[model samples]
Target: MGKTTGTRRGAWAAIRRLAASDRAAGLIMLGFALIGLVAANLPLTYHLFETIAETHIGIPYTNIDLPIGHWAQDGLLTIFFLTVGLELKQELTTGSLSNPKAAAVPMLCAVGGMLAPPILFMLVIALFSRFGPGEMGSLILTTTGSSIPFGEMAHGWAVPTATDIAFSLAVLALFARGLPGSIRAFLMTLATVDDLLAIILIAVFFSSVNAWYWFIGIAVCAGVWAYLVQLKRVPWAVVAVVGVLAWVMMFEAGIHPTLAGVLVGLSTPAREIHGETTPRAERYASKLQPFSALLALPIFALFATGVHFEELTPALMLSPLVIALIVALVVGKPLGIITTAWLSTHLGGLKMAKGLRVRDMIPTACACGIGFTVSFLIASLAYTNAELSAEARFGVLVGSLISALVSGILLSWQSKRFADATTDATR
Candidate 1:
């Protein structure tokens, strides 16, 4: 009996140790991201960055190969969306977003948040772009130009919208042991609202020139989704087939193919099964999650962010494209999130976790600025023009990295201070 208890305790301790290790590795990856940012901007690293940027990998059976980056976003990241969809389903079933009443404030804030950013960005462009070459002093937008010719301000619409959850949670993990649970919940709540808004913007605003055939394909994809919901003995393979078809259909439909993920995911059922083992739809999402998180996301991040900076030029760094991304994510996300949440909490009577205060919000809001994966994806969808995509992708790297770092710093400092205060008051 003594031996068994000792072994059991040892095993439990081992599990806890591993969990800690994973949390550490996550931060280290952020470190790698910082180094990557430095490498991307280095004058001597240009060749390496270009080589990595241009490298391709794809489905082996066909002649179809995309750069490592594209494979990550479109191919691998689809799995990420699958997981997101699954999470959304679970939320709809029993989680925070389960009911309309509970969801009202976050949903409304998310929509307003999305709309406000683009409108704000467009106004920024309308005002700044009129000034002509070298205008706005240093505040020029890097994402500019959508036939709108706002310099980099053209891409500004994309900047304020992204919130990187993995990075935010990483910030919380640094001292999550001592922090109030409500704060983490609040961050997740806000970011999830932010995500729904981001998805809508991508689907509606960023759509390509209409293709009727693609629209039909989308209909077929919708049918497949319906089948997934209706079929009594839905198989994982069927879900996979439908998911692939959804991607192809979205791509053909002149819609952003990644939105296919949201479609497929939303279509998946979260129904509890009776007199059986795993349910078909939930099983598929569960199996897909590991692949998406461990393999797909990391590979995507490495390739997408792995640029060498040998080509770094002061001119490029100061370009409107780069600066616009910085402004959108860095300046825009925090302001948009905080202002919206404040209004929602005060005016809309939205409830947050207890012990949460607006002042405690700044760090979490800053953390939301760490928009890595989706931000990079949106930068691609923002403009189909190749050179524009590359420039925007580079800008994503810069803005996201800077945002993650600063957010981490702010969150860490705030977490410590809050913990100390809580301990003092308790005493």
Candidate 2:
């Protein structure tokens, strides 16, 4: 019995260590996503995979019934957003975003990043529309063998605007040897703001709130949560129950239920209280982050990335949707970030963090183009047509993959230059 217990404890310790590592978390999610994709595409496995994803499981006679895939997207993913909110709150109170002057550059760059993608998406639509159906126009056809209207296609404009913090930071951690810590800080600040903007967009554009009274329940739960977290001897069980209730209210209220996680996180006390050495928010986040990284995100990725391509034709590869996403993420993200950083420094008189320059931001800006998690969510919400949604999700996957590869190469080169410079100075 003693030996068995010891072994169980050792196994759990190993799992925790793996969960804490950003690189491990990112690789695991990628592996699961690839599994999901391959399962969706393979002739022998596709039907079973689809049935599993489409199967519904929920409490009876409540507003909670959802397919398995949606449970992954909406239910499990809320834990990830909660962690995002906690980190955002921490940054706002004590980290890089604490000072307005220092934070201006990255915040503006984030805005610029969000704005540029939609513009590029619209431009691609115009290009296809202008050159009727031979080479360019043929690429714009939907999988259903019909032309997509400009308005319908334009709905996916927000898809490429997001930046996946986990994947981007993982790439940075792996390839950014000898780079200054400020580069990581800059990426974090930019991605955090990018997440905030994406959240607002989701709330405003995607929600249909007919059951406003349910918000009263949400508000009460939040108030109780805020009160409980502030106490000297907090009851964590009660807090968890209240948090779930808030999520249920948000779902019934027709707001995206994931926002409930954000609400609870934001409400957590960021300042130390009642003889505590550390703030409650920090402690809570540290405890929950492992779960979010290891379980919540990987499950979401598995469901979100199961895109089945009907065929592997050149037209599909060069489809307007596909081309637009690739350009928006690869070219537009970095272009917007660089331009805004320059403008803020030169014209607005804002400054970057110490030991960083606008030019130094090139690789990090490229990393910002990796829009995976939120982009997938937006794609599902933006289009009701199954074909259009599939196309958009596939585009997101391809675009994020390209951004990851490009950023990795650029970061490796930059790290080499920095390392050589350090060696010469030391000699």
Candidate 3:
């Protein structure tokens, strides 16, 4: 019994360590993604995998019958978003983002990164439309025997605008090891802002809120949550109940239920208001991050990225949407981030953190293109057709891979240069 207990303790310790590292999370998610893709494509496993993913679990007397894939996207993904909200709260209230001057560059970068992709995506389509009747024209024709409307295609413009915070930070952890913590801080702040913008876009454009009055209930629940959090003796169970009720209310309102996580996170006091053992943000993040990083994200990746190989034809690869996505993610993300950051430094008189250089920021900007999770979510929201959604996901995967590879190479060179300079100084 003692031996078994020791083994269990060791296993738990290892899991905790894995959860704590961004690199581990990234690698784990990447592995699961690969597994999903393989399972999706292999002749022997494809049918089984597709069946499982497509299986719908119905809730009796309710209209909540959704497939497993939808559950992963709408339900499981909320945990990851909750952690993101906590991080955002911490940064805005007390962390690096607290100082407006210090965060100016990243703030600009975030805005640029969000705006550029959709514009570029639409432009690519517009240019292709000028062709009138050609490869681009045929490509826009959906499987439904109808040509995709400009508005329908444009709805997907926001798909590539997101930056996958977990994956990008993981790459940074691996390649920029021993670098200044400020670099991580800069990336974190930028990605958090990028995500916040994505959330706003979803709420504004993607949502179809049928019953706006449900928001009144949501507001009430949120207010109650905030009140309980402010009390000297906090009732966490009550907070959890209220949070769920708020989520349900939002869901009923036709708004994305995940935003409730952000609401609760934003409602939490970032600092220690009641003289607690730890700050609310830190405590919640600690409690939740492990679940988000280790399980929620990887499972989502597995469910979301299972693209079949038959869809990867050369003509389809060269289609306008595919081209737009690749360009938006690979080119637009870094260009937008870097250009805006540079302009901010000049106009806002922003100063880089000590031990950080302009060149270092470039690769990190490149890394911003690694848009995976939220991008997938946007793709689903944008495209109802399975074929179009699959194409979008494929483009995201390819673009994110290119971004990661390019950023890794540049970061390695930067890391080497920094090491050489440090060694020379020591000499």
The true-structure Cα RMSD of candidate 2 reads 2.2
The TM-score values for the models, in the order shown, are 0.78, 0.95, 0.92
A best-first ranking of the candidates according to their lDDT comes to: 2, 3, 1
lDDT of each: 0.65, 0.87, 0.83
Model 2, span 1-427: residue lDDT tens = 9999999999988887887787888888888888888888889988998999999999777858899999999999999999988887888888778886888899999999999888888798778766645455533565446677666888888999999989999899889978999899889889999999999999998999976679789999989999998888989899999998998888888899999999999888888888888887888888788789899988888888886777745577677787888888888899899999999999988898998889999999999999989999999999887778887887888888899999999999999999999999999
Kindly report which residue stretches of model 3 are placed more than 4 angstroms away from their true locations once superposed: 1-10, 132-147, 231-234, 313-316
Tens digit of per-residue lDDT, candidate 1, span 6-80? 999898666445433435545544555555556656667756866776797765564456786666677777777
- How close to the true structure is residue 357 of candidate 2, measured as C-alpha lDDT? 89
Whose lDDT is greatest here?
Answer: 2
Q: Ten consecutive residues with minimal summed lDDT in candidate 1?
A: 138-147
Candidates by TM-score, descending order: 2, 3, 1
| Worst window of 10 by summed lDDT in candidate 3 | 137-146
